[model samples]
Target chain A: MKKLLKYDYQYLKRTSKFIIFPVVIIILAVLSPLTARYLNEILAFSLGDQAGMFNFPDPVVFDSYVEYLSNLSDIYLYVIIFIGVGTFINDKTKGLYPLILSKPINRVKYLLSKYMTLSSLIFVSLMVGMLVFSFYTYYIFGEVDLLNVFLLSLLYFIYVELILAIAMFSAMYFKSYITAVMITFAGYILVSLINVFSFEFLKYMPGMISSNIIQVISNSASTPDVIYNVVVTLVITGLLVVLSITKFKKYDLN
Target chain B: MDAIKTVNLSKSYNNTLVLKQLNLNVKKGEVYGFIGKNGAGKTTTINLILSLILKDSGQVFINEEEIKFSDLAFKKLIGYVPDVPVFPSYMCAKDYLRFTLDIFDLGDSMVNQKTEEILEFVSLPNSTKKISSYSRGMKQRLAIAQALIHDPEIIIMDEPTSALDPIGRNDVMNIIYKLRGSKTIFYSTHILDDVERVCDRIGLLDDGNLIVQDTVDNIQKNFFSNKFYIETKNEPKFVLKKIAKINQVQNAVKENHGIVCYLEENTDENTLLKKLMEMDENIVEFRRVKTSLEDVFIRLTNEKTT
Candidate 1:
C-alpha cells in the first residue's frame, strides 16, 4: 500500500495539467453562488417600485445553497469525469503503465491507487469551494445554520463519488483519453435524456438523481423520495466500482 | 545451475507464430550475446522472460524457480533496459530514482547512496534536468542507471547501442566491459563486432530457432576450412599447377605470390605441408587458413534458408 501511494504521488506530481483543470473548475464553482446573488439583486433594483407590488422574496442562504448544488451537479461533475478519464489513458499512451506494472506491484493495487488519488482530490476541492461559499453567504445574508451547511457538504461529497465512479469505469473501458471522455459525456447525456420521460422517472436516472436529492434536502420536496434516490445512487456507485476493479485486473497493460 | 533457461517456449500473435519451440540456456556469470537480424524475435523472447506476455507453450525458469507474473521475486533478480526508454518526461532524475526505490521498498538511508553511485557510474552525475529536456544519449544513460540501481544478478539489454553515434557507442560498450565481472549480461544486437569485442558466448537466432550456441573459439574451430596457403620463391603458376595435380588436393588457386590448396576431408595438414616441401624447396610460408565468424554466420543462415 505504501508503494502504491508513492507511485500515485509521482503520477500526480508529474501530470500537473490534470490537476490544474480541476482547480479551474473549483474556481468556477466558488464564483457561481455569488454570481447568482448579484443577478438577483440587479433584477430587484431594476424593477424599482414594481418589485414591491409583486411581493418578491429577498435572496437568502437557501437560495445560495440551491445555486451551489445546481452548479456542481451540471458543470463540476463533468470536470471530474474529464479528469478521471485522463488519469489512466495518459499512462497507457506514454508507455509508463507497463513500466510500473513491471515492478513489484499488482494490477489491483495499481487501479486502486488511481481511484484513491482522484477521489481524494475531488473531495478536497469540493470541501474548499463549499467553505468559500459558506463564508461569502454568511457575510452577505447574516448567520445561517452550521449543521445544515455541513449536511449539504456531506451530500455533495457522496454525489461526487458516484459520478467519479462512472468516469473511472469509462477510463478502464477505453484505451484513449478522448474516447473515454466522449463515452462518459455521452453516458451522462443519455441519462439526462432518459430523465425527460416524466418528472418521477427522471428523478431515478443517475445523473439527475443527485440533484433531485439535493432539492429535497433543501426542503423543496418530500423526504421519502429523497431517501429512495440517495439509496439507489449509492448502490449503483458501489456496483460500478466493483465492475471497474474486475475489468482493470483483466486488462493487458502492454 | 544455469542462471536462466527456457524450454520449448512458443508464442503466436493472431495465428502468426512469433516464437516456435525455442530453447536457450545461459550459465551463471557469462556474457551471452543474442545475435539476429531485425524482426528476429529477440525482443519477444526477452518480453516472455520478463512475463510481460503470456506463452502458448513451455516454461521459463530463473534461478531454478518457474516464472510467475504475480510473483515478483524473479523480477527483483533481473534488470531490463528496453531499446527505447520511456519515462514520464515531467520528472527530474533524482525524483525518478526515488520513485523507483520507493516502489521496490528499499531503505531510505541507502537510496541516496545507491542513486549517486549509479549516476556517477553511468557518467550522468550532476544531471538535475527534467527528463523532457534530456538528449537521447543522456536518456539512455539514465536508463542504464535505473536498471543497475537494484544490483540485480542479470541485466537484459536490447540494442543498447543501436541508435548512438560512434562515440556514444564506445562509451556504452566501455561501461558494459567494466561491469563484466560484477554481473552477468545478456544483450541482443545485430552488430557482430560488438559481440566479438565483449561477449564470452553467443547464440545465433534464425527463423525462430537458436541455430548455433557456443564459445567464440569453439564456433571458429567447428567451421574450420581444410584450405592451406603456401608462399613460394618460385613463380605461383608452377606451384599451383603441381598442387592441383596431387591426388589429395581437390583444387589449387593462385593468390598473390602464394598458392591456396584445398584438400579433401581427413587430409592431414602436416602431410600436405611435407608433400609441398618435397615438391618445392623454395616454399616460404605454409599454414592453414582460419575461418571467421562472419563465414560461420553466413553458412548457418544459408543452410537454414535452403
Candidate 2:
C-alpha cells in the first residue's frame, strides 16, 4: 500500500496535478476575498450613472468567508469531480491496466492509493486556500476568525472527499470519463436535493453538508448535527470506495 | 514444471462464445508461439490467463499452481505485454521502468542500475523525453523492457510485433530470441514468420479452439510430410496440368515458379519425378518442400472449417 501511494504521488506530480489543484485553489482563495471586498466598488465603476440607483450593502469579513466557501463548493468541487474521475478512469482508457495490474499490486491498494493521494491533494490545497483567504480577509476587513474559517474549510473538505468517492465509484462502474463525470454531478445534486427535505434523519445526511458549512462559518451550526453529518458522510464514502474496488476487480480491460 | 497452463478455459462476449475450452501447457524455458488470425480469441485468452477479465469457466495455473480471479501473487511471477502497449505519456522511458520496478518492490538499492540496464536492453534512450514523444516501435521496445525488468518466470506477450514495421519487428524478435532459454515466453502473434524464426513450439488457435499445438518442426512434419514442390524451366502451367493427371499426385497446384503436389499415401517420391522426366519437362528444382508455419496455420484453419 505504501509503495502504491508512492507511485500514485508520482503520477500526480508527472501529470502536473499537484500544481494544478493547489494553484487553482489559491487563485480562488485570493480572488474570493478580493471579490467579496470590492464587489460594490467594482460594480459601481462598471455601472457608472446607473450605480447611483441601487443600494449596496457594506462588505464584511464574513462575506469574504462566504465567497470563499461558495467558490469551494461550486467551482472547486466541480474541478475536483472532473479531475478525480479522470484520474480513476484514465488508466483503463489509456491502456495502462494490463501492465499495471499485471504487477504484484493489490486491486484494493491500487484504488486506495489513488483515493488517498487525491484526497491528500484536496486536503492540502484547502488548507492553503483557507490560510490565504483568512489572511486576505484580515487585511481588508480588519478582523478574521481563523478558527471559524478552519472549521469551514474542514467541513468543506469532508464534503469534497464524499464527492471524490462518488467520482471514483462512478468511474469504475461506468468506465467512461464523460459518463463518470455526469454520474458524479448527479450524485452531488441528489445529496443537495436530499438536504431540502425537512426529515430529521436528513439533517445528518451528506446533502446538509453545504448549508452546514455556511452555518459553521456564521457560528450558528449545531455541533451535534455537524458531528453526525461528518460521521455518516464518511461511512457512506467508505462504502462507495469499497464498491469501486469491487467493481474494478472485475473490470474488463480489453 | 509447465510455466503456464490453462484447462477448459472459456470466455464469451455478449453471449457469443469467443474463447472455448482452451487447454494450453507452455513448458518451462520454452518459447511458445500462439498463432491465430485477428479476432480469433488470442487476446481474450491472454486476458483470461492474466486474470484481467473474468472467465466463464476454466482454470489457469502458473508454475503448476491454480489461479483465481484478482490473484496478485501469480502476477508477481508473470510479466505481460499487450499488443498495443500504452504508457503514461507524461513519463520518460526511464521513469516508466523505475515505476515498474517500484511496483514490484524491487528495492531502491539497484533501481537506477536496473532502469538503465533495461533501457539499454530495449535500445531506448536514457534521456528525459516523455513517452508521448516516443514512436510506436519505441513504445513496443519499452513494453518488453518493463516486462523483463522484474525477471519473472514467464512473459506473456499478445501480438507484440503485429503492429511494427519490418525493422521494429526484427528488433522485438531479436529481444525474444535473446531471452529464449532464459524465460518462458507465451508469445501470441498473427505473424507466422516471427513464429518460425523464434518459437520452439507453436499453437494454432482457430475460432478460440486450440486446433493444433506442437513443436514448429513437428507441426510441419506431421501436416506436410507428403507435400513436395517442383520448379521447371518451362511455363509450369502445362507441367501442373500434366502432374495433376498422375495417380500418385493426389493434388497438384501451380505455385510461384513451380508446382506443389500433395502425393497419395505410401506413394514413392521417384514416381512423380520419373513421370515428369517422361513428359520431357526441364525440372530446374525438385525436392520435398519444407512447409512454413503459415502453411500449417492455413491448412489447420481450413481443415477445421471444411
State the lDDT of candidate 2 residue by residue for B1-306, as single tens digits.
899899999999999999999998999999999989999999999988888888999899999999998778888888888888889888888888888888887868999999888889888889999989899999999999999999998999999998899999999999999998999999999999999999999888889999988999998888867788899888888888899999888888889989999987688688888998999999899889888777778877887899
The Cα RMSD across the true interface for model 2 is 1.4
Over 4 Å off, model 1: A17-22, A40-60, A143-149, A197-205, A220-235, B224-291
Tens-digit per-residue lDDT, A82-123, candidate 2:
899999999977778888877787888889999999999999
Indicate the DockQ of the complex predicted as candidate 2.
0.76
Instruction: Indicate the residue-level lDDT of B270 in model 1.
Output: 81
In terms of lDDT, the best-performing candidate is: 2
Candidate 2 accuracy as lDDT: 0.89
How big is the positional error of residue A212 in model 1, measured in Å on the Cα after superposition? 3.3
> Cα deviation of A141 in candidate 2 (Å)?
0.9
Query: By summed lDDT, which 10 consecutive residues of candidate 1 chain B come out lowest?
Result: B217-226
TM-score winner: 2
lDDT digits (tens) for residues A79-143 of candidate 1: 77777777756777677754665666677777777778877776677667667767777776675
Candidate 2 differs from the real structure by a C-alpha RMSD in angstroms, to one decimal, of 2.3
Question: In model 2 chain B, where is the ten-residue run with the lowest total lDDT?
Answer: B291-300
